[model samples]
Target: MGDEDFLLDGRPHRILSGALHYFRVHPDQWADRIRKARLMGLNTIETYVAWNAHAPERGVFDTSGGLDLGRFLDLIAAEGMHAIVRPGPYICAEWTNGGLPAWLFQDPSVGVRSFEPQYLAAIEEYLQALAPILVPRQIDRGGPIVLVQIENEYGAYGDDARYLERLVELNRAIGLTVPFTTVDQPTAEMLEAGSIPGLHKTASFGSRSLERLATLRTHQPDGPLMCSEFWDGWFDHWGAHHHTTDVSQAAGELDDLLATGASVNLYMFHGGTNFGFTNGANDKGVFQPLVTSYDYDAPLDEAGNPTAKYWAMRDVIAQYAPVPEERPSAGSPAPRFEVELDRAAALFDVVESLGTFTAHDHPPTMDELGQYEGFILYRAEIDCVGPAVLEVDEVRDRAQVFFEGDGIGVLARTHHVHSLSLPRDARGTVDLLVEDQGRVNYGSRIGEPKGLIGAVRLCGEPLGRWRAAGLDVGRLDVVRRALRPVAPISGPSYRAGTFSLDESRDLFLDTSGWGKGVVWVNGFSLGRYWSAGPQRSLYVPAPVLRAGENEIIVLELNGVPHRPAVFTEGLELGHTEF
Candidate 1:
């Protein structure tokens, strides 16, 4: 970074980069995705380090399996490409808790992303743990990492200069020698607020490349112009229509951007699956949880296959940089099959075996129990007889109400339904099974806990002495121990089946026929799927499968009429605009 250009070894360099998150994609497919980026005429591959995924719990950090950060970067370097690492204490990349660990917010006193001592101390602890892996990967240290990013998009969140300053200092103290940069939308207020005097500034936008970069250049008058996040496609919400952008229109914009002699990084060269319970949500006035597939409608689809957009962008980039002579290889289609769910077990039959319940006078939120991601059961013994109004002050996302071992009704936050009428008597044990769809990944609601919030009331009276149980559902042994070969009753139950594969390959579990729930194959969670329009299938990578017989267990939260698990060669992601 210099007065006029981004200098690499005393010469001006334009970064032709594309974003591809390693956490989102399967570990086995990292090389394939990176190679495809090179095929698209990109010289650099950028990614964000998900703090929540790496350090899921405090004092417990994992870099093994799919969460291997070092392996991802080494693969990029092996392929002769540069890297940009954005390790954010607050990323806001539509991830769970915006990549902030849930335990960090347990103590309300610690003001996160601010200059608070407790919060800063936690940030320091995280950086200290992460530094060992990232320090040796910097470009100066014979590694591929060229530029390291500071707190991501701080201007959109808050304008705390001291907070941003401390973050930069922390990175430097950890021995990161690469040049630092701050990204924000191309606006005078954002560019001025997010960037420090010496830190290089970059803008993030999809269109109007000439104007956005001009806006960026005005603030960074002496530096090279760059669009850090060129959002060529968009993500899909649970019920919203699938989003797409015109290929020709986007390519024309790319031409206009290249014509301005500005550097650009496509926001997503490959948008992978939000595997397991890692998908996030958004809430403006309405709360909308993000679907299982990140897809993003990028050049590469969710299955990592090149689309028309890939060639369109490749042609545009060829004018600026050299593209590979060889084209990308086509992916093998998934085999289509259907397996009958012969075994079934009701959730209530196994809820007790999952975990022990905590006794509370008033129902506690998910954070209070140190349970962040899954479903929590708040059971209370209530004495009543016929139809009554059951009210939960706030349902985090969705709740299924049960009274005296009978299915009553559901209360959903999306529909603004807090009160529902119970058809049966509110006698014996009254249960409210709450599901944590996802934490708000952006805005002021980021740190708010999941599960049942506030008081639980029946007939205008608050319920007390509740026993709450957390169902992570990721516990294979517990679920295996609890699941029995019983007849399938209505409501929430575990549906199980087995199928044999001749060979292992990428597959998609068509979940359009099923209701809302999570799916697991051979104990590896394929993430969540819903009958709710947009996303109709869950991506199952071949790595999770074997040549022999394979088992799949589905925890169908809302019961479906049929008990058949279907497979598809391609993703049946509802509406097909992307």
Candidate 2:
């Protein structure tokens, strides 16, 4: 890089890039997304590596299918575009646990993003495993990768300069030769704390491009200014309105950033699905979990179709860079259909055979029981005398309370409701099925464990001798096997349906009628869908469907309504707000 500009082949070069996470999009569509990105007048594609996805378990690491990082880079190179990689052990991309493996926090001595020996050692192991794939694909090694990022947004989290230094050393030790970069919001304190010696400091903001870049210039001095995360739009939560940014205004901001001779990367060129239980939550004052759709309302919509915003942004880019003469074609219309959930199995009836429950004198948290994601059931023999109050010390996310196979009520952490009135003279086993609705991905509440924490009380008296069982929604083979041709059951039941299709086409399963539950198609999880608000349909990619017949299973925590599961040709993300 030159004193005031980025240099390529001894000449000035500006990086026009957009962020599209490979793990978020289907592997079959990676090439399609990359081709469209190139057609949009971009020269580079950037992505954040999700550590939890790659290394879900402590010793297990996966790089095949959707998690294939090498193939993603190859696709970018094939599109003749440069690449920038943010390999954060902590990437707060609204992902579960900020991409840190859940098992990493099981150890008490390991301090996250610190100089703690155990944490650093874990980071080193991850980098060592990841380097071989990236080392051979770097730009210096005749590959597309041009820049490698250090810890992501470190300054916003902590001021451990030594930790940043250790990350640099770890990358170098892994044979990474590309220029290192760090991203943070443009603030004196954050930039100073997140920045390290010799690493290019880039700002992450959506507005005030000139002012934000000036702040970056003050810190970077001689280096070329860049906006690593130009957030075009925002993500949605369950109850909130869908987020959107003004097309004209955002395009003008892009023009302003480019006018300053600054490089830019659109935060989400195409935001895809959170699929399964990978979505994250936030707890700043109140706990709000992210919706399943990671569709950040970008230029490319969740269905991979280019929107009006795409063309406006393209016009802005065309003034500065080359774009395709012919605009890309829109995606084909999605197919619509309906499937009736005929078979059913109640969770309460099959809980005993589905998994084993360990007897505990006191209820243990999901993490304490070695269970990370999914629901944990706590059952105890409670003798209710007269009208009494039932309370749990804390309910992480949400929980459904049952007594003698009857769902009395629901307690959600979001509303801070933990107690309910029980029936008079109730005597039976009390069941509390707590669900992990994605871990917090940002702020000081990042690592807070899920499930019921502390005591379960009846009339202000603590209950004991509880049996805890983990019902991992991801591993539901037993539940599938246990399904029978039965009538609709009440409360927290699994229902199955089958439908025939002539061809595989992208479709949306509208869950507006259903209360709350997770959906699985042909054994592959499409993630959770709630009738609450914001997102009402789950995007079912064509790849997960079969040519002839497909089976869908819904674990409706609340009883399934009489209406059939409807499918739509388009997405309905509810009301939008700026």
Candidate 3:
């Protein structure tokens, strides 16, 4: 028991594991994904719990919905699989707020991933609420959870022993007595910082770097050597080309690890969709935000089909943890079709009715207002003439500037246009509708403000009296829609239509030529779509679609559809060849 080896049910484990976040994958497909993982000769399945997803707000927590933690663990047990749960106050799985509840910012001094008392207090509240659910399912209590990880990747951040100690204590206080472990890059500093006196220390890497793997064993020579996270593939950013990991090369590396008698967990055996605004951003160097799909080019494709990586790895796994399972059926083709959304409605007309507006003297970020995801509308009157330029500061992700009701200019998170030139005689109610495309979930800029966090000026003078209204773009009500003749549309407009499908299967909404925006099918948010090349189609699962008529809504950032209307068809992921 004092040894460093991970003991599952009092026995040493050479666990073969694969990672899959339940929050990323649709709840309905949990069984299929888990089953496929097991079939691939995996003995254990790993997942990171999203705190923001479970307890979105402060006091109020929705453990149900798609984020039913209890149900998820139960399903894992039912599938005859063991689990390794990573409940992160800051998981950093490329998730918005790093899986942290954005409401934590209600208190200005709440520091993240540290021993800040306020932050710890919030973590305590979350653990107190969630631990009971998880503890009951621990292996000791006859459940599937074996290894419960501490605050994820703490070594990479800092050697905050106090914070790490408290996290361990929190889990223990909740009666979680399972063996604990942590994973970080196999570096001297990371291993030293990540390792507690007795806990298992594992290395995480995506390559067959013998030096790093050897370094891990040298640093952590006590228990079983494990590659806690072998990144199967990389994640794609909003404007960047999709990333693909070579199947054969990766499998070859995995083979070497298996030969070393090391336990392994595929970083993402099945990379699901980011769905909604839960997708995270990377601030390593330049601000690069992740795309909607988490199709990590893993063994399982985005649609949960076996890829070349799948078969290649399966062959390697057989030599080690042999298992016989039929290659799961290929993913259903995402057939594309066209629908004419003749009904168009402007959000400005219905935003006032959807939610109460928050008024502030100066601009405040979404966090300050307890707003998490969606659009924040800032309205202010500007008295300017004679071709004066208008500028807005800290335009979070994307902003559509309007003079009166006509578009003046658009500002993307990339800071393409900081100031807009005033049209000949521009004067009226100035509206800056800013969209929080995503929170920078990783690197230094974690707390980057959203909406207009700085000054708004007409040329040089700082302006105030900001009227901000948060648009819950993810949740839509029966917004008053009207029939409009086929004509060109200009500003941020919401389009709706009804499409009938007799046989429902996975479908791809092709948004090519249409301006960037979000897509929803039958009221289910399918995530964002940008015509900036790379990703042009949004995957709409069949479960959300009905046999009769399915309701479709498209939130066009700027309703300039090069095509007559957005259509559905095959998925054409990656950057479009110029």
Candidate 4:
């Protein structure tokens, strides 16, 4: 096929694409996923190459264990479909620190998604490393890679043309030959600032707004008209109810787009898990940690199962374009097992003795290591006699204070810096627990400092001689093996039990009764879920499950022993964490 065949003379190229993060879905399911995309009449598959996923440790890349981007691209090509690579040095797809490795924050000089010299140098290294794997697969090289996105949704951050140009030039210098594009809301100023030569500018629209299309046409009349990110569903954050967009309504909107001769890309064809500490927050000043399961109520659920939305979208696309003769069948069988553990215990009860410190002289500040994600514990003793006010001067985030092993008060940074009055009787020991929650992930002040920034004090005296405890509980292996807590299995602990199956298929780990924590199978950390608010259960991909007895471990925060955890054959658990 010729290049012109893909793009019409007057109209924009009719590219129906879907965004799927490679790390979320199992590596074995890559081909099946691409086939499913094609079956839904999708010609192109857009994906974000998560920097953290490929390079979990700084300077140490792991393309093994289902993270092979080359293999993923090959699968897309084998399906005879095009690919749009969004290899964001920083991809804020609700990923932790916007797909950035937390270790990067260790260096106080590194600022993200900007023109900072040190930051740009790191970005250049990343591009140079990733270019060889992707550039050769570009459509110009007879491969399926058609377009490369510069920075994602830049209008929400900043409109510096120089910054945008730097990104385009950086990618081009690293040998990306395909056409380039920028995705942003349909606006006049954003259009002018985010546009580049040889790069098409597309507007992001919602609710079938022809006015948006008119605005894009009026602003950049010569550019391609496409919906870069069509919101088929929404994402869920902690402490928020599960979000569900009307799939039928979304299908209708998609139909309207196809009828109007517009090219559209589903923001998420399959919303996969944030996985590990890669989940991100928004810019609303609220630290919204995304649920472990990124099942954004899309066509393909987190486990790669076809949802009702999937069929609806498939039928809608069939009306406009030619799909495959038969949809790809589900892949091989997944391993399931139950193992009775010796016992499970709480961490608080296992410690031999708790350490004590003075809260009068040593004050805890968020500036110790700069703005990083997670919780920081500060312990100190107060010398004041009688009742005193616990003042967390400039508490950048949230703080929970306990005086003499008694809960004193709670202060939310979103609300007030100083907590309520604390009743202290003649020089008592005090402990201040502060959780960073997370930095804002989107919008203008994306580079704002996160976590606690200043010191904690009481009654006009700075707390001194403190012990810092970092509570980054998501690291499964580290947390499980820590010298924290382990108890004898008094009752049930979702023990690993195995059953054989002739063929591999999707399955769901029902976490109905368990409290919030992480789940691991065959040594792979599935993701984090909480009984409080947000995600209740998790999607276990079949590729990760084996034919024999598979190992499963559950780390419950609350530890309810009587209630038994269950499993199902498909991804249809209905419990919401609202």
- Reference-based lDDT, each prediction: 0.87, 0.89, 0.80, 0.66
Per-candidate TM-score against the hidden true structure: 0.98, 0.98, 0.95, 0.83
| lDDT value, candidate 3, whole model | 0.80
lDDT of 4 by residue, 1-578 (tens): 12222353334367999988787777777787788888878999998877766665567777885778888898899888889898876677877656666556556787676677777776777788788788899987888898888887776666666667788889999898777877778888777666666567777765664677677767656645678788788888766787787878888888887676667789889887765445666646544556677788888877676878888888988898887778755434334543343334443332222222223234444434432555456766567777787766556455666676565666766555565677755376665556554545566444455444556556767666766555544443443454222344422123332345454556677666675556677667776666655565677766667666665656554445634446644553344542
Q: Tell me, what's the RMSD of every candidate? A: 1.5, 1.3, 2.1, 4.9
What 10-residue stretch in candidate 4 is worst by lDDT? Answer: 349-358
TM-score of 3: 0.95
Q: How does model 4 score by TM-score?
A: 0.83
- Give lDDT tens digits, candidate 3, residues 175-218: 89888888889889988897676567888899965666799988
Clashing pairs in 2: none
> Which consecutive 10 residues in model 3 have the weakest lDDT in total?
478-487
* Model 2 lDDT-worst window of ten: 471-480
Which tens-of-lDDT digit does each residue in 100-192 have in candidate 1? 999999999989878899999988998998898899988888999999899888888888889889998999999998989999998888888
How many collisions between residues are there in candidate 4? 37
Best by lDDT: 2
In the range 288-338, model 2's lDDT, one tens digit per residue, is: 899999889899988788998899999999999889887789978777778
